[model samples]
Target: MAAPSHGLTAPLSGKLKNVNFRIGFVELGKKKKRVFVKCCSSGFNGSGICIEKCENWKFDSRKINHSYRVKVQASSSTMPFASPKSRFVSKQEQFFPRCTPRNSGPQSHDAPPKRDTGIANEKEWGIDMSNENINESGTNEDGSTWYRKSGEDIGENGYRCRWTKMGGQSHDGASEWKEMWWEKSDWTGYKELGVEKSGRNAEGDSWLETWQEVIHQDEWSNLARIERSAQKQAKSGTENAGWYENWSEKYDAKGWTEKGAHKYGRLNEQSWWEKWGEQYDGRGSVLKWTDKWAESELGTKWGDKWEERFFGGIGSRQGETWHASPSSERWSRTWGEEHFGNGKVHKYGKSTTGESWDMVVDEKTYYEAEPHYGWADVVGDSSQLFSIQPRELPPGVYPNIDFGSSMPPDDEPPPNR
Candidate 1:
């Protein structure tokens, strides 16, 4: 039939520019089946290879399609020659397979609708539609809208929506919306279309609600004054009360005086000198003076007879006796005598009282008199020999004086007599 469709019999070969032209076949119900060759490629227009040059050729029935059907089968050894046919087309004539079908089955109701991916379309996707008044009616370059509600003219530059009063009232009057920019014009008036404005005031008013009216200057000033007055009154009440007094009293109480003679006397006195008056003989007394009369009087007041006592007008005690010198006498002396060689007049001088006045010498003249023979000088020297050159005496002259042996030897004569 139709020459058994010789198209299946030829083993296509050439440069094999497209693998779609290559194909293969297998016979049914036979072990030793025949081989058929047709457009030997995997897809239309030779998209892939059907048989590789180095691989063992095997008939694969699964790849067979209606367009490349098998008729007569040929053995692998039969290298059939192909004749020219008009089926081949140029490379540009090929068409790619379509990926998506025009119509899919009914879409599930749960599937979300596709949304526009562009940034401009995002506002339509459930964005907040509530109007917002930024300053006054103004449009950004991108067509975004802004508006304002209260206050003065929207500042300058890009500052759009602001407020102003009908009259030139300074921060205190009815307010109307005003638009502002670097340059002013009559087109500044516009409508405020938005939700309530939100922000905080300088005085800490939060923006939870819209401001119905501008804050009055007098109200603000009065509130400031009330706050300042409250603060000042609180400060003065605490500071001017008895707080400092109690503090000072407690602090000063550390030196509080107790009731006693010593305490009262100390308080009444101005200094240590005044505390004891002139009673104390210690150096701390104020009445102390270098004048001789005052010191003498002071000594007398203390039961001292110093004026008639020591040569320097000071008194002293010896044992139980209080010895004193007369006021006119600077020094006083006692007299005594001793005799040797049977108390004969030749041996010692006899006093008018006959009490053996060998010699009566006081401490001052003992050395000048040069008395001898049992005459005991006050300072114990029988050789009461005063000398103008006193330093030339022998070493023992002062220590070894014969106070007991009070007579010259009969064999000795008076010195230089």
Candidate 2:
């Protein structure tokens, strides 16, 4: 019944670039370099966005197993999809050319990697794998301030640490300073959230991820990703056992922004393909960002995409920050997005930080400014000491005012500050 060509002629080699073709098939990707065409083994059903390649038809020749016929060979990096309802068959390969499962039952090219029910799959992949015990510091107030705790429920959810010492040294010597840890794991109705706590400062700048939110309705919390290795079967030569996420981000308030891709190589012969690294937020800040990589089969040069933009607070705090530096020649894979505007982009999740706000402790106010005398007279009762503190200097500059309120009674003179 071969109908609907609409081009009257010339479909990909040259002319015939638009219109209704009686209505049917046109989705493509990549034009100048070849290989576009969304659904065309002779079927034809396209959409668009494939600026190179593709002149008339090329995406390995087509036919991705409607039920049988599994041809797909740009060399066979792989693209296997079979399902008796799918116990698990969505296994794609990489480097091009390896997918070959014409329905054989139990499903196995080599088999082995797929185990569940282990520490509940290591807390369903949030992975702490359980096992933590840290205890040493004891004394409180009288012993120069100290504390220590372990796991299984310390400061409420688990893990607690507090340390403070002066003259004798403990701030950097390590007496155990400000530390916290939390845990959670529940199943039935489901609840498996994760928390990461980090605070370091013995040297320069220190502070790391204290939050993580997965946009909710949580499909096990997006499986919480971050899987590095261990899970490779096809006999372990490495195929379904590694970490490879290409363009992975499913934005959904229900609007579903859309992001899902997978292109492997080696069964036949393409090479690399990546597109993971996206941190975009709108009203809450973190404007837009992307970290990309390419080299499936086009020319030879690996691709790159490091974008950054922040008109306002990207998630707030210190504001804006999204970097993805990785072009020393692909440098393994590629990653981008740094801090923008600076507020800190929720720091890691949730958002907000003026120390946590809500502190209305009026009346203890004390100001101290000596050198440039740049004005520090909010006063709250140091017994009215102002030798020559008439105020009026802004040269060298030194500012450290702590006004918990209460000390402004120098009799009508606390206005300039």
| Highest TM-score model number | 2
Q: Model 1 scores what on Cα lDDT?
A: 0.21
Residues 1-417, candidate 1, lDDT per residue (tens digit)?
122332334454443433333444434433223453343322211111122322223443432443433343345233222323312421111211111122211100111111211111111211122123322343323232224233433332222333221101112211111111111111112112111222221222221111111111122112100000000000111122110000000000111111101101011111111111011111211121111111122222111111111112122111111222334222222222232213221112222233433432232211111112111221132011110011233344332323245455679853212
The CA lDDT of each predicted structure is 0.21, 0.26
How many Å off is the CA of 251 in candidate 2? Answer: 13
Badly placed stretches (over 4 Å) of model 2 are 1-242, 246-269, 273-286, 295-299, 304-417
Candidate 2: global Cα-lDDT? Answer: 0.26
Task: Report the poorest 10 consecutive residues by lDDT, candidate 2.
Answer: 40-49
Model 2, 1-417: lDDT tens per residue? Answer: 344333322243322222111111232332211223332111111111111222222343333452213234433222122233322222211100112122211101111223211111122222221244544443222233334344453232222222111111133342212323333322211222233322222222122222211222323223222211121112223232222222233333322132233433233334444333323232222223333443333344444444444433231112222222334322222222333433222222111222222222223212111211101211111111111122233466443332546356668653211
Reference-based lDDT, residue 409, model 1: 69
